[model samples]
Target: MAWHDRAPDSFTATLWDGIGDVWAEIRAHPFLTGLKDGTLDHRAFVFYVIQDAHYLREYARALAVCGARANDVAGIRMFCEHAAGAIAVERELHESFFADFGLSEADVAATPMAPTNVAYTSYLLSAAYGGSYAEAVGAVLPCYWIYAEVGRELLAAGSPDSRYQRWIDTYGGEEFAEVVSQVLDAADAVGPSLSEADRAAAAHRFTTTSRYEWMFWEMGLRRETWPV
Candidate 1:
């Protein structure tokens, strides 16, 4: 089968398909359940948004690097468009978040970075800069896909007027969907170009990034030290 044809099901594509199942269970203490319900306090919400905004900056930077690495004008154009789109939508989303949190952009920009935040951003940057464009997409797609899926779910689970709804709406909207579609299409196209090892690597990178994404959210919800 083609590499793309061999990609995992939804369950398996999310990080080795349950390596962290035990940890996830343990981490799901009742307090952590608060996060599931989106009942985060103002401070936690602000912290999450601040850290998230910083991540978004790196997201664009990674996409740009990946575009250059692709060495194809069409690929580069897609990445550039994705980067511009991220800047427009994510920054505006962050601004809205800042307003919700009563924080200024400077305030969020100045906030301290957690280890998970740094590590996750670094992974994408490294992948984009040091690895091939296919690999870079592998690293970055999880963040976009996970947020879009989860955000859409969150919106469906409750009243549409909640503060959390706004957050979900921003990323779960059509603009973000377009980005996901673009990236996935890119992935499908690029998969055929990769060798077996590279294809496996891309798939692995994607799954790993997805797990980290879950942890990042869990950490933010837990309001604890950033989980690895």
Candidate 2:
């Protein structure tokens, strides 16, 4: 079986398969290929890092909401703590990049969210705040799952650029994989309880976000901007 098909659980397996096309496109995206080989443009990487910092803030909020809606103590603890980790842990990396590039808070503030980033984050926030825990989980899962998968793959390929290597190491490392597993386990735990409608809704959420994950890479690769 392909690596993408080797999901952690049956529920996650379905979610994984549901968007196979998106996954293929992600795998084929120039941004990812360039990243693996250290050929990606510095401008694209910079654009991605800034947009990601913004994304993580909104993601933390969605996660906190997931924690609030969690039915179990474990789920609550995981979501809430992971929420903190998103900001604290990931922000450290972003901050270092900011320093390297001589960017200040004011600089980040002045940078507009690319249209795709805006749409994607808005979709995530809506799913998180307007839906059930399962729904929120579905929406957020692709970010965890795809990054870990890509990170590991890219790490194995190895980049010549230490800058890209650092990112590859961060996501591809065991720590991030463990984080992905926890979320997959959560999906499995809740899978059986979801009603048919809820399950379908969650599935839709997964597919949609998975596509956004691809578009995100495309946005960075192309250096997307507002036409108006």
Candidate 3:
């Protein structure tokens, strides 16, 4: 029922292949490569997590919109459940990071969304709110897909830093992989039913968000801020 299950030149497959350049850049980025090797600065890691916490709030909302737009009970359940799961994981995992780093909730609350974070979340929310179901799926898929890809790869390298390992293990583990596989299946299931216009729109949404996926890492590395 998922892409990997029945996939042969599937929609998500094309989406994945189309982003080869971006995907390669993501692999090569120092922030990510450092994550695999465990040399990533703890400050940058914490900064990334705080920004991710902010991003997840809106992302969870977009996911709910995906549920709302879903044509079937299965899609509805998947998005809604993951919406809750996103928040739950954030609370458990991020809080552990904060505790280990001596950060209070106030510290996380005071940290602002970097400019790119704003732009990226804004794009996701816009697509979710304004687009068709296929478009919404496209908007949200990169986050699920890219993180799983990166996390699995990083887990293989097995970061020496226990903290990074927790992050990698969460994304790379069988459970998370199952979730991603389900989403990919959902994309394939819906692809044949969409109109040409909607399919094009979905492709555009997917490609754009794929770029933002890369920008997110740059944001962490640079601690991006508003220039003004």
The candidate that wins on TM-score is: 3
lDDT of each: 0.68, 0.89, 0.89
Residues 179-228 of candidate 2 have per-residue lDDT tens digits of 88888888888998989899899999999999999999999998899999
lDDT of candidate 1 over 127-217, digit per residue (tens): 8887766778888877776666655555566433366667767655776666666666666667656687887777777766776786676
Each prediction's Cα RMSD? 4.7, 2.1, 1.5
Model 1 accuracy (lDDT, Cα): 0.68
- Tell me how far the alpha carbon of residue 175 in candidate 3 is from the true structure, in angstroms, after superposition: 0.8
Pairs clashing within candidate 1: none
Question: Ten consecutive residues with minimal summed lDDT in candidate 3?
Answer: 1-10
Candidate order by TM-score, decreasing, is: 3, 2, 1
Candidate 2 C-alpha error for residue 81, in Å: 0.7
Better of 1 and 3 by lDDT: 3
lDDT tens digits by residue: candidate 3, 105-188: 999999889999999999999999998889999999999988988887888889888899999999888888899988998999
| Clash totals for all candidate models | 0, 0, 0
Best of the two (1, 2) by lDDT = 2
User: Where does candidate 2 stray beyond 4 Å?
Assistant: 1-9
